[model samples]
Target: MGFDLVSRVRLYKVLERIGCSPKQFDGSPSTPSETNRGVKQGCVQASNLFGIYFAAMLRHAFGGFREVCGDFRLNISLKKTNIMGINTQHPPNIHISNYQLEAVNEFTYLGSVVTNDLSLDTEIDRTGSASATFAELAKRVWENTKLTLTTKILVYKVSILSTLLYGCATWNLYSRQKKRLNIYNLRNQWKMLKIKWYDHITNNEALQQTSIPSIYTLLCQQCLRWLGHVCRMEDGRIPKDLLHGELNQGSRPRG
Candidate 1:
């Protein structure tokens, strides 16, 4: 809700579309293209279809990269490098220096699921399960009478909510997804607080006892906080551009 000023869907799409040619990237014709993290192998998000130019760019970008003070060369692990088509049904096989990268429908990046469908359902579902596991594993702590309710709530936040909200700031949440997450959070709370369905404790009353805001509010705060960080970025920064930039030409193919 707090992200009314910026479209999370648009921003996420652009993040996958942002990239540059090798020459434009490192300011040298022979140098490999550098990514935001500057790692030897990092994600490169192309703005166009995966085809000839994209393959060529990858080849050029993978060469001439080495340690600054040594002759060490970087060898990319083809097993780890995967390519996928975002909206297109058929993406061509991309060959880089005689090695063809594998194509996938989805992949896990930084502990989150990324799919061609551009949806967060899988990630959210997985996180919900993980949070439930976390809560169940701490059953003893939840039932400890020696521990105050405040202490239990703090543990819940640290152990379960932390896992559930990982990378949530960048999520594009719809009403259905939001409701699903809230249901998971509420169920976890019920178990932790030893509230049975027959107890007839309203969800609001349970929340009031724990003094925890709804998952929707927590998500909004996270998104707004990240937006503030992006707003302060200098020009030509990828995160800032991903938030405000648009493709110069060509639209993504229909699925």
Candidate 2:
């Protein structure tokens, strides 16, 4: 009641200033903040740093890691240290022990081509071998009138499809990829039935003729089976850990 609205606002601002900078009245000198320059990123958050200072952060981390390795008397092979940035246009040029590591767009790990874009087409290329496998036994199995369609289908499942979709249980397929797989399955079925495109047979008719499920259905079945296996696996198993483990870090802050 004693002060106007303007006076009250001014008073609040003055109190806030006094509360925030207590060191001004306490006779203690304020310490200067450490900039991103030559800063250790492990202790400091990288989000606060500018992009130009990122090299310093890398250098700091590399130096610290090398020091730790030196203390442990462990050798790091510079040739084995390769840098790859996924889904990025500009990859970072990384140097370890002053030797620049090779930057790769894709690399093979255990026979799988792990590309930067995670393209399913690369995986599809491996299906050529499955095609070859399917055709290899055409004279004895697929073409044999003595074999029932069911038997042929079973043989296709065990021989051809197995080779085609070796790691399909863990597949994260796009609509296009799913369609391609379906087409591949249907085309192979038509070939087994000796039905051509000009035979006036619909894809569904062909499916009914073979009494076979879609490739997507097979994928779902395999995925469910894999899920069951993962569920039964020991807690320390890698697959179990991958399925059930909680991440230490969270998503980046919204812009």
Per-residue lDDT tens digits for candidate 2, residues 52-129, read: 232232344655766744433335667666677889999769776777778888776645667888777787676688
Worst 10 residues of 2 by lDDT: 1-10
Give per-model TM-scores: 0.66, 0.56
The deviation in Å at residue 41 for candidate 1 is 16
Q: Give lDDT for model 1.
A: 0.71
Q: At residue 190, what lDDT does model 2 achieve?
A: 91
TM-score of 1: 0.66
* Candidate 1: tens digits of C-alpha lDDT, residues 83-161: 8899987965987567787888888876889998887888887865676666576646787888888888898898788
